[model samples]
Target: MKNKFIYLIYVILSNLPDFYMIRVWFRNITKLRAKVLKLLPNMEISNGVKIYRGVKISRNSNLILSKGVVIKEFCILGGTIAVGEDTQILSYTKIDGSGKVTIGRDTHIGRENDIFSHYHNISDKNILVNKSKECFQEIHIGNNVMLYSRVAVMGGVNIHDNSAIAYGSIVTKNCEQNFIYAGVPAKKIGERI
Candidate 1:
């Protein structure tokens, strides 16, 4: 019983700030500026780093950004989206979760990427507000994985340790440990470095 109480308190405490932050950000979003006002830059955010207002970041103190990691307009990040040394994230990417989102060193991500951990209940609109109707899953990306622009990654998708995904790809399937993939539903075309 005590453990349950502690767990409940911890969960609420962790999400309270992030939840409110996203709310305030969306409420104050302008036509040009993205809302990252809820995020206090602690570690190095680097030059040319752009964050959208609806980002769901964990503690800023625990997050670190290397040089040249650029997030474009309407890009959502707030979980532990730790860019490794000298990695670059191009425009219009979305990352949301409290689960681990570890980007490898020197990985490059292209534009219009949707990365998330939570799934909304689209079947019924009002049921999504019940808090008990939501389901979440974690996604893990490998070191040196290069995902091109306009990639749509659904839940339960994992790219292995060193793979490259081509542009305009819909990743409904996972690629092998070291391969290159492309197309609407991406598939392993060949092995790559």
Candidate 2:
């Protein structure tokens, strides 16, 4: 089928180190090299992983992704994004963090999932121009959790192991083990099968 053919071609293209060498050559010639190098602050990136075009990584962060992790199209991230082996962050999953985000082993975050560690206090009218410094918190997603499509996790939340967060759920608290939670401010629906 045409889809299979396209995938095969993609696999072949991804394997070609010469293509990456050419990319490096082209990148070095451009004015964007400084801007590109400014993105990675502290990170150890392994080879053979696909970093798509237009991906903006942050400058001050610890990002260590193991092999075969495909960070797909237009996915912008910043923070401690330590993806375990074979984890896939699909398209447009904004793993933005001012604090810390530790995604445990073997997790898959679906498209457009905003896992933010913390946010600002814009409501404080007393402070002029919101002059208060960045407020950060920890977001710990346990092992083997599948965050379905469009899931948004707020700051300071801990998700337990073997848990699955359903689509469009806004998680604002701790999710227990082996549970399925889906809703605004996501709650426990039932036990997973």
Candidate 3:
């Protein structure tokens, strides 16, 4: 009952236009918001964590937002996830963390990006893909990564440190460290020096 009430408060606070406007004028409102978020069950929010208005976090989510993490407006985060310090998730991004998803520090994720940790089982040709059992896979993103706008990271992908993903890329495999990837299936285009 306590958890439900807290979640209700969070939902109400997140939707309030006045609260959102006040946050723009008073930066301290971000801290206040973090305090409220910390009250939710299975949530660990550190100092300087900013969760902007219109961001939806599922009730069952086990989330950890490190210090200086900024989640922009209209972002959807669910399941078990941990974001390192100073990571920024831009507007309209969706992180479906049905499995564990860990993002290292100093990472920048551009707007409208989708990071998914779950997929439907497709081994059975007799059954529809949508109707198949869901499979969960962990996604690990190393430090100082940059993901451009509209990128789609599929399940079981490991993006190494200092990597940059170009816009509109679909990541279906592992990304090596210090590399730039782009394309429909996200191939290595260049290496970071």
Candidate 4:
């Protein structure tokens, strides 16, 4: 009940335009917000994990942040998201893990990157208002991966280890390990050196 109350407050705050400024202020004062989040049942934060202000998280969501993870300011990351050790998620990144999003160790998610683990239901013609079942798929981002700015990773995509996704790319499928991908649909451009 307590966790749900906090989640409701966060949901309401997220809708506010000045929420980002409020979060940045919270980051400057202390780690109180982070400490409060530690009380959530599904959240696990190891030592040295830094969550900057203006980051809206869900209490009911399973969010595991390993050691040395730094989530920058103004990031809306929530749901069943597991960020590996030492991974850095830059500002303005939005991760929706309503299904599951697993980001591996030493990964760098650049600014404005959007990651989604679920797609809205709009398939059924009979029920236009209600729609069909939601499409929920997991997103697996492997170790040492680099997702550049403005990257949009769709649901059910697997970004393999040591891969680098170029800026402004849209990933729709599985990316091969140790390669560089770019452009719409994110084709393999070259091998990672």
lDDT of candidate 1 over 47-143, digit per residue (tens): 4343433333334324556554444444556655566655666656776654546666667778878776666656766654655455676666667
| Model 1 / residue 154 / CA error / Å | 2.2
After superposition on all C-alphas, the RMSD of every candidate to the true structure, in Å, is: 10.6, 10.1, 1.7, 4.0
After superposition, the stretches of candidate 3 with alpha carbons farther than 4 Å from their true spots are 18-26
**lDDT of all predictions:** 0.59, 0.72, 0.91, 0.84
Q: Of the candidates numbered 3 and 4, which has the greater TM-score value? A: 3
* lDDT digits (tens) for residues 102-182 of candidate 2: 877777889988999877776777886568556788999888899998999988999988899999999999999999999
lDDT of 2 at 116: 91
Q: What TM-score would candidate 1 get against the native?
A: 0.60
Q: Model 4: C-alpha RMSD to truth?
A: 4.0
What shift in Å separates residue 16 of candidate 1 from its native position after superposition?
28
* Candidate 4 per-residue lDDT over residues 10-129, each given as its tens digit: 455444343445777544332444555667678887877776657777566788888888887788877899999999999999999998999999999999999999887776667675
For candidate 2, which ten residues in a row score worst on lDDT? 29-38
TM-score to native of every candidate shown: 0.60, 0.74, 0.94, 0.83
Query: What is the TM-score (0 to 1) of candidate 4?
Result: 0.83
Candidate ranking under TM-score, highest first, comes to: 3, 4, 2, 1
User: Residue 48's C-alpha lDDT in candidate 1?
Assistant: 39
